[model samples]
Target: MKQQYTHTKLIELISNGGEDQENAIRWIYSKSGWVSIVKKMIRNLGGSNHDAEDIVQDGLINFIMDVQKGKIQKIEGANAYFIRSCKNNWLNNFNRKLKAREIIDREFNKEETSINEEKIFVSKEIWEHLDRLLEQIGRKCKEVLKLWSMGYSHEEIAKLINYENANVSKKTKSLCIEKLKNMGLNPDDWKY
Candidate 1:
């Protein structure tokens, strides 16, 4: 039987907070165990090897930070959590780019047509509200919704957003939508 490295062991090493913890992290990745897990996650998310590598590096950094801060108790489920964080971080970057593109599109369109001051004010207000709503959501939830809005397939989003799978993504999305609904913003009212 293959030896299983539990997250608890990693977490314990991390929480110990010393040179030993650093060495443990190095060993985990250097030994190729964590790298393989990260690669699998990256492939599931439809990301390139480079991107996956970056995410894994980021995840490790985050894990270290959390451990140092006494925020993470153990590594019990750290792998899943770390993967989720990496996916959310990546999606957040992607969403920012998407928003920037939309803003550029609007600006170009505005230049092409005459916009009334009242309409511009209303648009600004709507955007402000949307921004507030985005801020209200937890980071993971916001990332998931943003990826869904970007038209990523459920399977891709599951990998990117750290849901169990595509089906979980769908259910989670519905929950997110419900949260939006409770905010009194009907999807039908917004002309996307």
Candidate 2:
């Protein structure tokens, strides 16, 4: 007869970082369905297989640290908790890449190869003005526009913001764009 180890027992081995840690981690990955959960989350977040693999590795490291530090007191439902942590880590990584892309786009879109101090100062003022404008448009409009600008699909945005449907997300985004246009926010103004 084969002996089956429960999740709590596996976590104890992992949390202890003993000689059995590697085996416990392997069992959790295989038996607890951690790999599939992370892969599905990464795919749904528009990430590739490589991203899923990376996120899974990062999540496991984070989970081990949390367990060792006594952050995860209970391990009976650790599989679900670990999946949630992986999803959060993937989302954080996704948002960071999006922000980096936005910054790169803005920097390269400018025609001049050499950036001057005056341009930097002017850019700061322009960004401050844009921030004030976004504040004026109200929180909901700002939230929707920010999500749209991050390249999320209407359905994804709807799910994130709790809208009724993708159509509502689209309509709300369009309305917000119209409001910004009405406020004299010329697209050309931000091109530099």
Candidate 3:
């Protein structure tokens, strides 16, 4: 069994671009390098195989993008970084799914309650405003902001969104946030 993942090989493959990058990806998959890493992460995190695969893909994308942008200079402990990114991506995805379920449950329960019509109308209006603002932002920017709002760290956001690094993610997030601020929505407006 190949114990060491050839980080230099992968980086070189990615840097070369075109068919070389594709071949490198194929090599990784063929060796089950990322898959094994993700499986271990999933097991550690108590996630399923499917979740592990998803996380692995997310990490691979991040690594490839970073290499292509010449953002990652050091390959020392690259495997550790890959594992960390995969775990973070899995956690973020899991949290979002769990939150979606909570929202659905709340909505179902609310339908059974005798809530005042006025309050419902106000809540709907607020959601609509949020939706409109989100629509105004580009899809990528909206996703980045939403992930940030969900309390994902800069590193996690970079992995999830395929930014070159946390610094890049922070800068892009700042730009998106400024756009939102300019549109008149302040942090104080957030209920939670």
The best-first sequence of candidates by TM-score reads: 2, 3, 1
- TM-scores of the models, in the given order? 0.48, 0.53, 0.51
**Residue ranges of candidate 1 with Cα displaced over 4 Å:** 1-6, 111-192
User: lDDT of all the models against the reference?
Assistant: 0.70, 0.77, 0.73
1 against 2, candidate with superior TM-score: 2
Per lDDT, the best of the predicted structures is 2
Rate residue 126 of model 2 by lDDT: 71
lDDT of 3 by residue, 53-168 (tens): 77777788887776665666565756676677778878876765665565567777874423343333355466688789878989889878877865679999999889899998
Worst 10 residues of 1 by lDDT: 112-121
Tell me which residue pairs clash in candidate 1: 7-75, 11-75
Give the TM-score (vs. native) of candidate 3. 0.51
| lDDT of residue 166 for candidate 2 | 93
Which residue runs of candidate 2 sit more than 4 Å off their true CA positions? Answer: 1-4, 74-76, 110-192
